[model samples]
Target: MFDIRLRIPSWHRLHSFLGLGASLFFAFMFLTGTLLVFAPELDWLRYSEVRASPQGSAKLSLGTIYDAAARARPDWDIVTLVRSEGAWFADQVTGVRPEGRDAFLWVNPYTGQVNGETSSFTIHAALLRLHEALFIPGRLGKLVVTVFAIPLTATVIAGLFLYRRFWTGFFRWPRFSSRSRAWLSDLHRLIAVWSLVFFVPLVVTSLWYMVETVGLNAPATPANRTVARDQLLPPDFNGARLDAASAIAAATLPGLEVRKVILPRRPAQPIVFQGDHTAVLVRPRANAVYFHPESLEVLGAHRGEDLSLHQRIAEAADPIHFGTWGGLPTRILWGLFGVGLTALAVIGIIIHAKRVGIMQQKIAGASARSGFARVWRGMGPWGLGGWLSVGLVVTGLALLTRNFLGA
Candidate 1:
């Protein structure tokens, strides 16, 4: 039923070595990734009351929602208005207060009622920062995370070649009665094979993100250079501007469900409506309609289908990375797989360390200890488990301090 092979390929060794060396980073990614799956749900915990949907047959227009937000915080500058999830048609206004504090307010799209305001600092945001950038300061953190992706991608590629019998062992599981090493080995291989499809795509998407972030294939046009969403161009319009609701209603694609409406505060800037099709797995901003802010005339529109091959691949990265393409169930599945990958990394490290310990013992001719004892000692006081434990505690404390304790 199974082929007994004693020989391991060079790629297998390389894969194991890379995974072991990068186990902590991989673990961190996995842990944060699992948290990110329910990021929106986590936000609800912080804004339970504000996030609640109002019951009504008729929906209030975006103009009313904007008016409500303006009424609530007349002094604050509105940076963006995001369409909130669920049937309530709530809009989240994120902007800066005159005193310079970041402000976040919610408005019911149906009743034009202010749902309440909250600080911009959220648990979801913090965890996402950790996941995306590893808490390193600025783009450097993102660069560090991206740098680690190179090795991660290599590990996945090596694994594909290293475990050639993956298909054959697809249904196998670690034996409960086996020795620790045997059980771990079996479990590691089982996870590696079973998760190949998801693992490979995730790594590829990660690489794609890194490439995009570093501007490898960025659009050549000077106008196409992306601007940070929070960075505001000073408003030149002191007079009343055209309403966003009317502009979006007129400009949006027939099937496009608007997810965000970005207003233009400066001269010559367009009001952009970003949305997705009703189809599953489609990402927000998969299609966008840009309108002349004053004239309410369509300036330009870009749909996912209109992208070139390379651009399509680049655009597809986010949806695939977050598993948002398939909705909630897929997100849950990806979360579970993330956990398994983390566990696999731990197992891989332990197995490699154990083997290294045996080799060290043989070379040293030391009989002071044997088996797992030797392995444990070889791992030293701040070994894999020790480092991981410390990391977890520190991460928890950092997040708790920043969020709950306001450190």
Candidate 2:
């Protein structure tokens, strides 16, 4: 039977209580995701060095950028070969490794512009795992991430309610004198109110992923090659050819910097790929692709603003969380929300510690009377039942895996 007398208060509920013990990790991820909204613009600022030229139109051709990258940094892998656009300058990384670093760079395909180098920070990836998925590894990681998503959703709901409960707490912040209780309430209420705006998108967007990937709809997205990469080469080059690759390589971005390149798959197929930094895909100013890999031809192109609705919303995920989507205002909102959640996570631990301490004292002080003993026994079955359910799930999965392998 449930322990009615020992019921958990709604106000005392934590994300962990809602099965999102790891919600903080995603919270952190959600925060940084907003920053990624302007990754293209930000990349330019973070990695490139700019200078005003004679304001010319044409820069070096695409060949120049690719060659510069390969020659300037021979040891680095070419994850991408950028061709600059008008007034942008022809620039590319020229040298880099992608696995552990930021993999950031910029080039002006016009003037053969060059930028400095930087990689993803160790702290960034580590904290990212800590926030979005709790750094869980393999299949187990998926389960943990899924479980945490539950409480994270609940926390958002509860946060809204809690915010309402403490709405008035903000008005008096500037004038009120500081003390332990006053400060705590002040901190909670103020952050909660401000946090509501930014976190709403985080919850809504991440929740979409959860519903799509983990809920009843998982099968809807199973991959079947969204499109075939038509590849054609000399029969010697397998079933592929290189029609556009050579021409595209020789092409120039006119006067702008070529942010990225989207080339059709090689050997030979009926498609083409081109990339840009400013466009958002269906959302424009975001990203995606278009192609007919068979003929090695340019069928169509997708820029940031030229994406479809579903694609736009989907693309919004990174920008929504990182602050890149809405430009400065929206990005700032996300940043504030992320910082606020971090603070919320910290305060959450304190509240739980206090409650746990109180509970321990109460349990210790209880007399060894028959009535208390009887009460404790009643709660045992509930705890035991939960444990058994978990055991059954574990066993069932193991057996299923073994049987599948045997078959």
TM-score of each: 0.79, 0.57
lDDT string for model 2 (1-407, tens) is 88864665564354335323443344344444444443444544543353224344655555566555555555554445544332433254433353423253455555544554544332333344434444445445445544545557787676665456555655556325754434665675677667767667666766665654454332211111224433322223211133234354224222222345433233333222244445542232233333343333444434555555565566666556566555567656666676677676655534444444445558967534343233223222443422433343344345444433542
lDDT of 2: 0.46
Q: Can you list the residue pairs that collide in candidate 1? A: 281-325
Residue 47 lDDT (model 2): 37
Model 1 TM-score, 2 decimals: 0.79
Locate the minimum summed-lDDT window of 10 residues in model 2: 217-226
Candidate 1 lDDT for residue 313: 73
What clash count goes with each model? 1, 90
lDDT of 2 at 396: 39
